[model samples]
Target: MTTYRDAGVDIDRANEFVEYIKEKVKGSFSQELVTEFGGFASGIEVKGYREPVIFSSTDGVGTKLKVAQELGVHDTVGIDLVAMNVNDVLTTGADPLFFLDYIAVGKIELETLKKVINGIIEGCKMGEVFLAGGETAEMPGFYPEGVYDLAGFCVGICEKGDVITGKEISPGDILVGIRSSGFHSNGFSLIRKVLKDSGVKLTDKIEEFGKSVGEVLLTPTRIYTREVKRLKSQVKVKGLAHITGGGIPENLIRVLPRDVRAVVEKERIPENPVFPWIQQLGGVEEREMFRTFNMGVGMIAVVSEADKERALEILGKDSFLCGYIEKGERSVKVI
Candidate 1:
């Protein structure tokens, strides 16, 4: 009989892969995660909060995965998967409780898949989320050999009234931005396109960044979970924005109250050598650069004027009071 394996699908191997992944996934479980891996559904107990608010975010690593494929590095992309989702949930003052990943591949090699899962575990640990469960699809014809795609779903929780949705954003609210460790998984399509057009190989090293293009591009997405989780307890975060595909203005505006605007000082953005180097090499315009890249500021917190000093003191060197809010159209003016 011509069975399922004839269609490039190995049911036995898929089950074996699940067992392999389940053991690794179990390492991230905590008391909050009630469901074990390999279950039809995952469950979390929401016992503590007065009115628990569940926050969820889903995202992928974007084109930065190309760098990983080129360099044969599979580990860090798993962290990128977790970061993209959990970081978004953190913006809402929620504590990430658990994460689920979706990895689709052509053919599953045990070693490469292990590295990916290991990185995911590391990321969940960093973000304080339990690796509850996930789905893996192995379709040989759909994907190229050794090529895979990753995405994840992260669910977090906070007290109902405690969610920081930027409704309180007003004039004089300080814009405290946290520094990014480089590109942080956004805008890689542009980066790759620019490099390819310039005939600049990923291995090429220039004077500016002091690292090869691939090295800069492959820097894993930062998990600001620890910092933001701490701040959730001590500070009143009126607004939070994760700098992603739309860059500052677009993402920041999502949390800004209507009739308010953020005035960012361009000079205050951290001295990120990678951006200027890429700009010069690609001859990208200043405005285009800001709209496309993080420009060194990855995450931002908008807080009340009274808490500005306290926030600065608590945040220490990781935060920058990049600007203040003003009464105007909902806009961001980088002066």
Candidate 2:
């Protein structure tokens, strides 16, 4: 008489976990979420637009999870999961409507999963996106004990005519950079390699950080949905780029028109101590650092020089005049 539980898949515990999650995250669901938790699929209403364009994005936290898992802190990674997905859809000037997550682990660890879910709920509230639903998978052999992975899916809606394409970006357009909240879920493979080879411990604290390496590395990614939404309402944003794994040059060029070039004043990107610390510690080159990490600029907005002042005002003190579009080939130059 063999049972699923005997195979390390506890169906009973999974059932209880579902019920526990239902109780924990109900408040985070938005008014537009028509379906309740534990449903096979969730539905959301897209109202307020005569012609609505739906956009979506999916992302994960990458290897940053290793640091979180090693530190026994499961909450912040969930926020990273939401920020990565939500910010992508926001690049298109869309309003994030709903979100779903997938969690896979070797065993059903109640304490760990609870913290992860709570973080997701907090992220949803912060981003104003509804927590529609998600899945929890128990795979014994596939994942090691106490180890898990998370992925998030986001759906956003925008008015069809209002979609922001870089087509409008031309020479003399101003580029505004919104500061990042640390690395924002990219470059962890290099981060880990640097950590291992450079001989830095998570518990170690440097004068600049004022916190342990673990705490700094585990910082939650910033969600720009709110700031972007407000900016678009007033300013004529020609293009927007969400700086992620590829950093500025790679990511920003995607929104550049073929006939122009963007020259980023690298000196303009606010100084973040962690980046300098990593470069000095690992002896990494400046070019590779910009290509791999955000280097403190998380999002960039392209606007006509006329709207530049208004855009900066909306982005507030954290924003800076990072670059300007010019007539040249379709690429970004950070000098």
Candidate 3:
């Protein structure tokens, strides 16, 4: 007879991992939360607001985790997980209320797991959301050794009428782009292909960026919570775009209203060293580059041209006027 552990699922180790995260999750508790840890489902009191709508998002770190595993770095990817999910919720103009995570691995490393939880805790703090509860599963045969996968879910609340979808976006709305530090957790498969074909390793430091290839690749995804939440109440934000996998053309246009096309000057996007380095090394084409990476601008804000200055002032240093909306097909033009 085959037992669960014999079948490659170690229940004991999974339990230990769950216990390991208990205190960390509990530390992020808020007064609105009802339950913490060891529950089949997390519970929270949905109170406040005249009329409230709950917005939720679920996302993962994607293939970026491969670099972390190869480089023996287990932290920060948790932030990427949180950013991916929370930022998506922010697109709906909701305040993130709580988050849950799912971590699966072939084997359990206490130290690495601790570091991972630490990163998640840090991410929760950054987003100002409670860490509700999560699951950790050890499947020895399912994943390769020292390899893990991370996924997270975030729930946010917004007043019923205050949620900002792109429905209100109109022609002539100015597009404000917030700069990204590097490749914010998308298109790592292309990155890995480029690096592998070019015989590049994580240990090799690219002179242009002055950091190891892995270091640049593993930079945590940025949290736009502070910027979006701050500006939402004070400005007429017609739409918000979280630049991820499909880059600007695909991601930005998703939130654009019909009959509104955005004209983005290519020169307006800040070019960073790693992008060109990868392009020159891998012989990747310009169009593929824009489709694959953030190319410096991360999150975008579509607001009436009248409120442009106030939006920039509210977003502060990292924000800039990247482009403007025009009357055309619902498309993004990179001039």
* lDDT tens per residue, model 1, 27-97: 55564457445669877666778888988999999888888989888888888899989989999989998
* Each prediction's number of clashing residue pairs: 0, 0, 0
RMSD from true fold, candidate 2: 1.0
Error of 1 at 235 (Å): 1.8
Task: Report the lDDT of model 3 for residue 283.
Answer: 96
Give per-model TM-scores.
0.95, 0.98, 0.95
- Decoy 1 TM-score against native: 0.95
Candidate order by decreasing TM-score: 2, 1, 3
What candidate 2 gets wrong by more than 4 Å, as runs, is none
Which candidate order results from sorting by lDDT in descending order? 2, 3, 1
| lDDT of predicted model 2 | 0.90
lDDT of 3 by residue, 64-125 (tens): 99998888888889888888998889999899988989998888777888888888888888
Instruction: Tell how far residue 108 is off in model 2, in angstroms.
Output: 1.2
**Could you give me the TM-score of model 2 versus the true structure?**
0.98
| Distance from true location, Cα of 207 in model 1, Å | 5.1
